[model samples]
Target: MTSQIELKSGTAMAPADPVLRDFRNFLFLVWKHLNLPEPTDVQYDLAAYLQKGPKRSVIEAFRGVGKSWVTSAFVCWLLLNNPQLNIMVVSAAKDRADAFSTFTKRLIAEMPILEHLKPGKGQRDSNIAFDVGPAGASQSPSVKSVGITGQLTGSRADVIIADDVESLNNAMTSTMRDLLSERIKEFDAVLKPGGRVIYLGTPQTEMSIYNRLPERGYEIRIWPARIPADPDKYQGRLAPFVMRMIQDGKGPGTPVDPKRFHDLDLLEREASYGRSGFALQFMLDTSLSDQDRYPLKFRDLMVTSLDPRMAPVKLMWASDPDKRLDIPMVGLQGDAYHRPMWMAPEMAEYTGCVMAIDPSGRGKDETAYAIVKHLNGWLYVVASGGFKDGYGEATLKGLALLAKQHGANKIIVEANFGDGMFTQLLKPVVSRIHAVEIEEVKHNQQKERRICDTLEPVMNQHRLVFDQAVIEHDHKGTSEPIRQLMYQMSRITRDRGSLAKDDRLDVLAMAVGYWAESMARDTDKAHEEHLESLRDKAYEDFIELVHRNTNSGYEIDEPSWLN
Candidate 1:
């Protein structure tokens, strides 16, 4: 077939044969044949990266960038250049992979320049697997499609195109994300020597698998819909071409591809997908987005050393320059623990102490506990930890000893699991160790919402405080960061199961909720009530002195001046 393209304007032009060798030229010819508009600047840049990028690379572009279409055309260019090379397309689902292959096959069949590479007789011709006409006999087809979880043992490929393999459904929980990570490892075994693997997708969460691929020696390049104001968030991961544009004075909110997504269009999309969603999907930013989505802030809680028996009568919270703690923080960006700015000189005994337990059986879950003390109008977290031993004797006795050591007046156990069996088992242990009152509490509302509702307000008011030792203990006690209390507090959202393991945060929420009524009392009103009680006691003592004198043998006499 001649490398000539006929334009819609009823004219024919034949370019040099070497022009077709460039993937960008090939893409232009394909677009003309499909009667689509001319390729945008960003699309041309994408084509350039596909041709000259590293062997193992990732392409993270915003939605509606037409990345898949450009890639499909590039696949045709690859076969036109070398028909013997085998390629594989993988996705989270089988149908998506098939669609990619189908589009590539259609391009080869319909385009005149690619007519020589069309599948011939006695060759695999289906969409799932197909071979080019000029390819020699081989064990693998010229192009094949499969899901990430499908059979990938015996196949081999020179190029692997992973198209949106990390979807929201497959990467919701830690276990599911782990399984997906393991499953994708099959690509290494299926890859031939000196092969290339390309990943194309947006991140689903802050812990996205795409973010971890860089540690394995894969070079990543990201292109957002607009130039980012905070380029530091990308950590120099932005495409060199994009960085150049930014250096050339392209301000933030300026559309990277004005032909496709203009300012008005992007604004509409931003409104459609809230700020967080737009940040994740369009901007490819996870950290700043999560800071907006998650309600709890680590800096809101006052961190200080506290005596279990007594606490300051009044404390003030501030986020001024000197109030920020220098401790390690795992919360979102710009979030850090803060110490109180001021504290009263007077100290008083705690009103009550309560222990809350989030019970769990065996397996990956843990039975978490927290001890909280209530004062005038504030709550203090003193102790918290998790027991992986489940309902075993060690776990029960450990919990009993913790309550006894903390001088807890009541123990509240979450009865969601095992139908109150954990509470019953704990009763015998507590009877022997501390003899504290145990109460079973059942919850019908969603766990994430409940925890956030119970904690966000108190944290916002700076009424919740954490002992410095508790923060240190929580950080060092667990090998898995997800099980840590501070981790749970900083990462939870209102969405159900937003946290993989929330037992630690759940118990903390329950303990804080125990003093909800007391927290409702205004600080000034409580002080006034205390003073009124002191005055009533003084009046009663004066009356008692006069009555005692009247009952005595000697009668009470008036002052000499009065006589």
Candidate 2:
């Protein structure tokens, strides 16, 4: 005669197995039934902890490592085995939450010994609490699963597991970021006091919740898989973590070769994704591999001033393949310590200059034109605008006006893309405007590669100065351009030419190319202008020095010196 002994979720644990009697023993027993091996160092640590420690009682592992399976089993064992303990599981996304719930349901069904514990509800359904315990236990524990983003305001949890708190693939997008921030904030508020949280995810950004978990006082666990102790070994740590995890469930088997744990052959076969898959999945360092994100570090281009008072400079305009205008063209005019200063209205009287324009015709984007002069320092950025009707005619007209107004000596424009239209459509309408003579040429390099190859020396030598006005135009201008430049600078050369994210960076590279061409030209105009300004300022500074010298009784070798 089989007696019906209902478990919390209403499945009957007929014949009352003793191993399924308690949470800890149930976890161990079910692992055996599922044919999983025993736990490893991490697994043992997790299974033992409901208390604070240096190692996160709550932990995160990288993707594709079966984190969900282990965690789900852990939660179930806690609830079904203990009559007094309730467990709550949360995931960053709906899919992940659903997955956790599904895993728990599957574990219940697969082990007939624990099959009586199954909650009669569907798998992946959230907010369902199952009364899981032996009948007449005085109290029964409840296990509930829910999305982290759901309405968690008034809810309570005993043990919360948050999985994949931020979206990895779409972290950089603005819309995605807003959603993630809300999720993090809500998760922080939900867990009950003394209730523990186990957060899991790959580190996608420095600002991501997984990375910021330490700030909230959650202990951290970092596992970098693909990075070999040495460059040659090439084996990853994923295999080791998995082996340990599986071992914890069953019992330790033959010790795994750390190298053979992660399938090198499977990864190697897919060559293009080798670095990313290994770095993100195995190592769990998101910032190191996320190429599309902005680089927080600053790269110094030029150390010189833009003011003629400091140093005069020639200016050139470079247009890239996209013919984007309004892109910044930077120049250095003074030493590193001094920095370029814009010519004040008073100082503009003595400056003469040439102008360059990067023209874009009939596009939604703006047209960029610069009037540059050599004063005490280099001062460019004459004027910028969107083309009327998005046509080149307006740009050419503006260029003519800028040249005449600024007394420009020469105009340089790339005739590669419909630039000849300027001469035909614009020259006839405007006087004193001609297409600058330069032949268009194509190169074999990709945009990212070209920028890396050419801009490295310029950046290292401090020869390029990004315009402050342009770089800080807005968040869009600042974050996007800087993000691309860093990707180019950190070129993944050995990996056959792949850098993280680099679209807008090509515009910045065009600006660099313009500066290189301009600096190479005859500096006679800029040099002469610089000297004149120097002479004018030298007299006043010399007089001040002389007055101080005389008053302080420091010997002044006036006519005594050069005189």
Candidate 3:
């Protein structure tokens, strides 16, 4: 039973002047006639943003959110309301771009109210390109479709829409990404002045092209599937905040369209794709969805949930790999140096401990440090933390106190930035607090590669142990230094595409390198001690033998004394 207000079938086509004036009314009409579901809040927001069109608007909504459908309808609405207006649709591939124009063509042909906007049979009519009632004032086609990577040297449009411009297969690598980015720049030359630019897609990478649109004065609107959890802190207008919301359980409580995505539906999707896939496809979280790229996972890390502060040495490995790292490893790849695999303490005493520091010294970057203990063939982490505070006296003094508390023998400082400025600055602080040997070290290998090479072997053998504090971190983007550290650890890429800085990783790698060097030194020292002990024992045994022989009344010793 159709509503009484619904347009009757076979009715004479007439322009609804009122709807022509109001875009929302036009959308309501389209939805009503198309039998589409009622618009959600996000859908309405999309309409409002598109209404402002001809500026730059990016629709970073989740998959199955009807962004393409809505954009197609908007294109139909644009042409119906003003036949003279020129529009173009672009996508990652020609097939997707054709879909946009095809849908628009259908809307114009089927909608009775826009009978006047139908394409002239002799004028121009096709799936990829169509003209509405011929070109009088503006010769450019009323609607055109082209792939972003396709040739478009002679095309022009008053309004250019880039829909799903990036796909996983097409834009996965940096080379493909650069080509796509550079190709899109041609839109500037082709677009008429004051023309509208609308982009619709979910970002596949952290360095998404959509992420850079704002810098060019393009207004961006991101409508994820779920409402952002710190609604005030995160306005649901970007993918970064979407990651935060999901990380902190801020959203997916209620979906945009409850009928389409109920709680059970969302839960099922979550189970199917796991955290990474669900985050990328549904939550629109580009930053959170990449777990496969990192060399390490939290599951791989050997961690004790029991707080170290409360339960000191509750966990120990035999041979005290916690303190000494020179415990000869049996299996090693490459140079085959003995790298100790630490264990729960059946018995052992660790021999050496070192601290490594990466001083960002404020300006929004973290000043991070790591303390590690080495046994004969094993390594154990003592403590790790970072601060945002600048290299102030308090920050320096606090670090000095932490190093002393950890009983670290040597502190290695990354001397990349200020040429030992951080180490020199720490000297004054440590000289006043408690004197500790600090060595300035420079890195020749890049941070990510060094970390991967050094830590991968250690972690692969299950040698490294993490404190509860680092293990228990929530890893929310808003939580700052701690979460940032975990995100970098789990999210950093071989390409280094996801993260901007890795202070925590840098310092931890330095600490691992320091301990590796100590492994050799400690082995030498132990060998020297063992040799001295043997010499002393031999001397004592000889004396005892001489005493025994003299006390036994044997005169052979007198001949030796005379000689």
Off by over 4 Å in 1: 1-21, 173-175, 267-280, 285-289, 320-322, 326-328, 362-364, 523-563
Kindly state the number of residue pairs that clash in model 2.
44
Which prediction has the highest TM-score against the true structure? 1
Q: What are the models' TM-scores?
A: 0.85, 0.51, 0.54
Per-residue alpha-carbon lDDT of candidate 2 for residues 1-563, written as tens digits (9 for 90 to 100) = 01222334333454345534433444455555666664444444444442323333335454443556667777666555543455656665666676676677667656665555654433222334454434233222255666666766565566767766566544544345546656666754655666667776766544455555555676665443333333222123233454454445523222222333444543552364575555556545444453433221233432232343233343332323232323333211111222333322233442445444444557433344444443323334332222334445556666566566555555544344474654455454335554343223334566545756655555444344444443334223433332333323333232222334343344344434555655443444555665577666876787889999889988766543233
The parts of candidate 2 lying over 4 Å away from their true place are: 1-27, 40-42, 45-58, 62-64, 81-86, 109-141, 205-208, 226-272, 287-297, 300-308, 312-462, 466-563
Ranking by TM-score: 1, 3, 2
- The lDDT-based order of candidates, best leading, equals 1, 3, 2
Error of 1 at 20 (Å): 4.3
Q: For every candidate structure, what is the RMSD over all alpha carbons to the true structure, in angstroms?
A: 6.2, 12.6, 14.8
Global local distance difference test of model 2: 0.47
lDDT values, one for every candidate: 0.87, 0.47, 0.67
Off by over 4 Å in 3: 1-8, 11-16, 134-139, 230-252, 290-563
Error of 3 at 120 (Å): 2.0
Q: How would you encode candidate 3's per-residue C-alpha lDDT over 434-521 as one tens digit per residue? A: 7878898887875677787777666665556665454344233235532355555654556643345577777887888776654444
Q: TM-score for model 2?
A: 0.51
